[model samples]
Structures are given as structure tokens and as C-alpha cells.
Target: MKKYLPLLLVVALVLTIPGLNLDQVSAESVDDLNKQIKDLEKEQLELKEKQDGLESEKSETEKKIQENLNKQGTVKGEIESIDQQLDTTRANIQAKENEIAETNKEIDSLNNKIKELKEQIEELKEEIKKLQEKIEKREELLKDRLRTIQKNGGQMRYIEVLLGSSSFADFISRTAAVNIMMDQDKAIMETLKEDRITVETKKTEVEDNKTEVEDKKVEVEDKKVALESQKQELVALQGQLNNQMAEKETLMAELEHEHEELHEIELTLAEEQEVIRAEAEAKKKAIAMAERKKTELAQLNKKEPAANSGNPNGIFTHPAKARISSHFGMRYHPIFHENRLHAGVDFATSTGTPLLAPADGVVSKVGVVGGFGNAIFISHYINGQSYTTVSAHLSSMSVSPGQEVSEGQVIGATGNTGNSTGPHLHFEVHIGGYGNPVNPLPYLK
Candidate 1:
């Protein structure tokens, strides 16, 4: 924030100054004016100090803003990196899902094969059961044949049948019958043995098929479990990546907000510095004006003889033979970009144009005067009124302070010097004192 110390000083200085009695002169008033001028100079020094402080503050704030920008840039890079991680995680998750799906398909296939194998085992069981039944029936028939042979005498019965036959032809028929009986018993035993072997083979095949299907199913199930675990891991990775992205984004937002705040502070500090600098300049000018007034008043008390007494109306002649380019008033300043007091009338002319004294008066000031460059001040006492004329922005000066100069006398040549835009004569008329400015056009002859 800008302090208005300079403004307060202006008010205090104005109040301290007593109204001048134009006809009388006093030494006490001049002393009081001198003390006020000293106070203004002191205040101007303080304003400059304050301006320096503001400049330092502004510089620090700008540094902080730059640091914040750097942090934001780093955060942006982190966020981009997180985005890439998220992309990779998402892709991995999709791949895991596909693998799980393939595992599930494999499991389904194994299950189908197990079911078919079970059906095949069941059919084999049925066949083994039928073969066992046939073997049991054949064993029963062999046992009956053995009982019949034991009941009747084995060889004697056969011999009796052969003896009862009437001829050899009858005996041969009995022998053929016995041979056919033996062959039938042998065939039954062989069939029972073959049925037992076939049952064992079918049972073994059923057990092997069941074991193979179960093994395949277990392998497929294990694969599914692994795929599911991997998928879960990928999902977790994706979540972590998302969290990182969100955190980076949040940090970036905070950094951006901080940058904005610091930037605003820097701008405010700069504005305050500008205000302080401008106030300091005003204070400096005030001191100079007060000093000039004090000198003029002191000179009046000495009762110095009038430098010239030719003009009756106390009007001034033109300071330069040129047209008025700018009039005295409040107007927009081209360099400062603000509405400020022009303070003087400007005469358009080329470099080295002769500048003349506007009135017959004593040269009160002749030197470089800050922004005014090589300047001249002439104090005029006419018709019981005090006036001071100022001619500034000179390329060369020919007059000296306290020298008596006549109206229309060449005191200097104008040029584009010290705060001027071009080579021209800047003329000002101050009434009663140095601070009280008035339009010189009205007083010009």
C-alpha cells in the first residue's frame, strides 16, 4: 500500500506558511519559510527510502512467483508420467482379463472331457457285469455235468452202452457221442476264462480314463487361479496409478494458485513503488520552490533597486520567436501516461533557437535545474507585485545569477534537454512566489 506522507507534508507546509503582505517585507517570515523548506527536504529523503524498500519487496515477490512456476512445471511433468503409467496399467489389466477368459475356456473343456470319460467308464462297467454273469452260468453248467459223471460209473456206463448195441455200427455211434460231449465242456471253460480277462481290461481302462480327465481338470483349474491372481494385481496397479495422477493434478492446482497470488503481490508492490517515487519527485520540487521563494523574499527586504522600469503594465514579451506548441494546464503527459500539470507553455523551434528574458528583471537562478536542464529564473517586481519567470531546456546559457537582464535579451538557446521532447523553450510565470504558477500567455505582450 502506498503511504501518503508526501501529501500530508504538503498540507502541513501550506498551513505553516503565512499570507504575505505584498507591500511590506519582513525577515521573520523568510526564516519561517526557510524552516518549512528544510522540513520538505527531510520528508523527500524519507520518501526515497520508502521507495527503495518497496522495490526490494517487489523483487522478492517476483522471485517467489518464478519458483512457483517452476514447481508447477515439475508437477505437470509428473502428471504426464503418471498418465503413461495408468495407460500401461490399464493395458495390463485388459491382458489379464483375456488370459483369465482363456483359462476359463480351458477349464470348461476339461470338464466336458471328464464328463465324457465318466460316461465311457459307466458303459465299460455294464459290459464287465454282463461278462461276469455269463461266467457264473458256465461254472454252474460244468458243476452239473460233474455231478452226473460222479453219480453214474464213469467208464462202466460207457462200456454198458457199447455192449448193449446189436452191431459194430451201434458201438461206433456211442464213441462219436462221447467225443462230442468232451469237446463241448472244453469250449465252455475257454469261454469263461476269456470273459474274466475282458472284465479286468475294461475296469483298468475306465480307471485310467478317469485319472487322466481329473489331472487335466486340475491343471486347467490351477491355470485359472493364477490368471485371476495376476488380474487382481493388475487391477491394484491401475488403482495406484490413478491415485498418483490425481495427487499430481492437485499439487499442480495448488502451485498455480500460489503463483497467481504472488504475481498479484508483485504488481501491487510495483504500483506502490511508482506512487512513492512520484511523491518523492514532488517533494524535491517543493523544496526547490520554497528555497527560491525565500531567496526572493530576502532580496526584497534588502530593497534592491528595480532592474528595469520601462514597461508600465508589467506585461512580458515573448521568450522566443516561435508559435506556442503546448499551453499551460493540466493535460495528459505523454511520457508518464497520466494527467499532470504541464506547468509551462512550450514554444516549437529547432535546436539552438535563442531564448530571451520575458521581462526586465534580475536573473535569480542560472544553472542546471534537475528536469528543467539548463534553466534561468528572473525575479520581477512590478506594480507592487512579485513575479518570477522561468525559461528551461536550454542548449547553452549566457546569463548568470544576480545579473540584471533586459526584456528581449538572449539569455540562452533552446534544445531538447532534460525531460524535454524536442528543442523548444519552456516558459513559466509564477506570481508572488515560485510555487504559485499562472498562464504566461495572459501576461505576454
Candidate 2:
């Protein structure tokens, strides 16, 4: 009973909320509202009971759906999924409808029971009242008899009546008269006692029945509230399911478009990598051709690659002002839960945070390439080693392909775009080509 307090309070609040005017309620109106509420509650309870039965039906329906999926072709599987949803929804609605009927019948039964109990209680009360009155009358009569007997010397009167006989015939008649009076008083006294017990017994029985009825009424009211809430929820869910079926084609088209878009992005990335390979080949050819005139070029230009800065391994700096939220490794993804290589370290940064260039390099590609929303790929040939740094999931980019950038320069902004969960830099360092990746954390200053 104590556990029911919260539920009751919730019901009260829900019914009274949203600008309901308490002052507008008259006694009659309150009574009417109470009657309606009780009816709704009862209806709700019945629907809920029906819902329980529907759960079993739902389970069975789901099993049927699984069977369809297991045996059907791809196209049929989709159609079956929708059909299953419709079947489940229809089953739920039917259950609630049946519940409504059952509830109404049960409510009628409860009302009839309550009426009978009230009538029985009233009859008992009337009987008790009558018995009380009878007992009172009997009590008074008995007291009067006692008083009369007392005035005439009580037990002595009986003896006197028997002894004070004029003749033998008179003695016998007086003795009979005394005996009849005593017996009549004793019978009335006994009747009074019995009536008192009868009144008390009826009163006790009525109290017990009244208490039982009150408890039952409370139980019915609570069940009604819960059922009403459940029914409304189901109604709303049914509407949503109907809408899904109506817009099935639109949803299917959207999904197809997404897949096509992904394929295009992959093709674009492949094309860009091809362009890089072609450019690298061209450079290598030019260097080979220049080798023939190496002595003459050395005499003209006595310059080698720039030396490492005063700072230790000063080839790079942090790409953004952030801590490493995720480390690069073969691990399960947070969202997909698939074990895949996390190509780069994820620097947890706010959206719009500037992504600083870790080293002087030429930007190779910058565009909406794929899942890496707005990406920037930079290529560097330092100390005869070809290295590429790929920064992905950018909110915005400041550099373009073929653009040159120095260390600490802003190339892009961090973002939660492209297959990303939140705003963070997905930075990767690749050796040789984009295919080879090593941890970026080892290079960050």
C-alpha cells in the first residue's frame, strides 16, 4: 500500500495539470469527474491486463517474423519486417479493444456487488436496530417485573401465595398463579439477552464487509489508472508504426542514397592516391635526369636540406590544444563495437578549434572525401623519408591541395563531422604512403 503512494500522486498531478481550474469545480461537477476518472481507471486496468496477454502474442509474432527472415530472400525480408511491425501493432490494438470490453463487463459486476453489499449492510443495520429496540423494551419490562416482585417481597410473595390458602382448592390455584408469573419474567429476560447478542453480531459483520468493499474499490481504482496510461502509449505507438509503413519508400530511397555517396567518396580517395603516386613518379624521374648534371648543379647551388631545429626532434608540434582522448591501436570502436585499427590518435578538442600543422609540408588533398568529413592530407619529404599526415573529421578547412604550410600553421578546425562521435581530431601519420600508419602520439610535441 505504501508503494502505491507515488503512483497515486503521479495520477493526481497528471489529471490536474495544464491550467486546470480548481475553482470552477462544483460539488456535482466533482462527483461527475470522480465517476469519469474511476471509469477511465477501470478501463485502463482492463487494457493493461489485455496488454499482458498481448505480450505473449507479440512474442509469437516476433517468432513468426524471425522465421520469415530466415527463409525469405532479401527483398521479401524487408517486406516481411514491415508486415511484422504491422501485425504486432494490430495485435496490440486488438488486445486493448478486447480489454475495454472485458473491463466494462467487470465494472458492471463490481458495481452490482457493491450495491448488493450496501443493501445487505443496510438490512443488517435495520435488523440490529429492531433487535436493540426489542431488547430495550424487554429490559424495561423485566425491571418493572422485578420492582413489582420486590415491593411484594420478591421470593417471599411466591411462598405467601402458596401458603395463604383459605381451602385446599384455593392453595392449588394460588401455587399455579405464582409459578406462571415467574416463568413469564424469566422468558422475557432470556429473550432480551438473545436480542442483544444478535444486534452485536450483525454490527460486527457489517463493519467487516464495509472494510472489505472499501479496499476492493481502492484496488480497482489504481488498476484503472495504470491501464489508461498504457492504452494511450499504445495508441501513440500505433500511429508511429502506421507512418513508417506509409513512408517506407522514402526511407528506402534515403538509405540507397547514403550507400551511393559512400562509394563515390571511396572512389575519390583512390583517385587522389593515384594522383599522388603519379606525381611522386614524375619527381623521381626528374631527380634521375638531374643526376647526370649533379656536379654542375652542386657547383651552382651548394645548399642541402634544412637542418633539424634547436628543439629536440623538432620536426613536429601538437596539431591542436587537446589531450589524447583515444589512442591509435587495433581496438573495438565505441559506436560500432567492431574491432578495427584506429588509424590515428584522437585529440579531444572543441569544435572550431584550429588544427595546427605539425611540420612544413604541401597539402595533397582537401575536400569532402568520405567519412573523414573535411579532410587535409599533407605530404613531407624530410631527411629522405616520405611522410604523410592525414587530419580528418574537420569542421572547416583553411588550406587547399598543393598549398604549402609551415609548422604551427592552422590547416583546419576540429569537428564532430564525418563518421565521428564528437568534436575531435583524427590524426594519422603514415610512412611511405597513406597505406602505412604508425602511432601519431610518438611524433607529437
Top candidate on lDDT is: 1
The sequence of per-residue lDDT tens digits that candidate 2 reaches over residues 267-356 is: 544544453543343222222223223354444234332242223433456788877899989986442347878789888899999998
TM-score of 2: 0.42
- Per residue, candidate 1 scores C-alpha lDDT tens digits across 1-445 of 1355544554455553466343333466445545555554665566567677777887887888888888888889888888888888888888888888888888888888888888888888787778778888999998988887777876576677777888888878977887777888888998888888878887887798789889888888888888888888988888888888888887887777667556656654654454344434333343434433555544443543334332334367778888889999998644235797878899997889988877566766676665676778776654334567888889999987657666678888998886677788899997744546898877876
lDDT over C-alpha atoms for residue 221 of model 2: 61
Worst ten-residue run, lDDT, model 1?
304-313
Worst 10 residues of 2 by lDDT: 283-292
Q: In model 1, what is the error at residue 110, expressed in angstroms?
A: 1.9
